[model samples]
Target: MLEKLPLGRPEIVVENGKQTTVAHSLKLKSAHIDDRLLPLLPTAMDAEQMRQRLAEHFREHLPNFEFKLSECHIRQVYYHPEKQCGVNYRLVFDNGNGTVFHEWLYGLMIPQGSATGRFERAAKRVKTSRVVQPFLQDFPPVSQLDDLQMILWLFPHDPKMKRMPDAVDPDFMKSQINEHAALLLDLPEAEARNWHCD
Candidate 1:
């Protein structure tokens, strides 16, 4: 069914060499998510154990590249040892990539909650925000996760897409999904435009 429909949503494809906005570039400065850091932090805050759950990604996966958050400025931090759900370790910087990751991971648990926490910028695109992290060992296919992976599967390594739960689409969603893949694959802006605007 998706193959028959034409893509109408035009995307704003910014090239790799292309310069990003001050806010965008600044955000890049504090981007990066080091999976290695996962084990470094406390097990509870590091990650949760569940059959299926959503997770927000970061621009860099680790903004500082080292994932050294020994003193990450905590804003509206959340943590629940009993429920194993909370935003206990999040970095919210008002300067440049403020709420860069906090908001991102927060978006991951939004559908289940009231979408609390800060970085209130009208959540980006859900297509890249919602993800199903099945632990490398579990390795759940991007398809099995379904709605959970609706947002994250498209852009697995984008912080901007982390809190973008409002980005996914059911209306010609495939086109949007394909458009996302094109953008990630380093397709030129002109070429990507053709894909999304088709």
Candidate 2:
């Protein structure tokens, strides 16, 4: 299991002399691989299978969230005994009420043998397994259509790092959301694609 960890503070960005802080990163916990499955890595399972296994583990162990491997948009996966094993993927959810939410997950598998022991010793704390928490306490909750649209507005910015979109008016956009919320949320799927960063 993984222990819960904050994804760090929101990043501050300045574009065209205006500044804004973005908050959208998902919180994650570290999870260790089962010792019994150690040998399967270099033998029974390839990179894709390993990713699948970890994703399934999360879905099975975590409560209040759901994801199908088929619906996942896996962006990266890599494993190596000498360094680390990690996976990054995107998950989308629909509330069936004209509201949808999307989140990105990144997990790093525990390193084995001496490295694992060293990490624990260095931190001077015993590690505990935990299920991932989807959002930070400070994040705005999606209670209605407007809230969902606001979250969607944040999709293009990375919460963990400072980034400013080109030609964007951070303060103006924030101020104008109430005026444009309905039109933005009612946009067709094809037109809405323009809102996301490429």
Best by lDDT: 2
What are the candidates' C-alpha RMSDs? Answer: 19.0, 17.4
User: What lDDT tens digits, residue by residue, belong to model 1 across residues 96-169?
Assistant: 43323222223122232222321123332222333333222122112212222112222232333443333443
* Residue 120 error, candidate 2, Å: 8.1
Q: What TM-score fits each model?
A: 0.20, 0.30
* Candidate 2 per-residue C-alpha lDDT over 26-132 given as tens digits, one digit per residue, 9 for 90 to 100: 22122333334233223112335534653444444444434443334444433444344334445544545555556554433333343344333422321221112
Worst 10 residues of 2 by lDDT: 143-152
Candidate achieving the largest TM-score: 2
Q: All models: lDDT?
A: 0.28, 0.35
Return the lDDT, model 2, position 85.
39
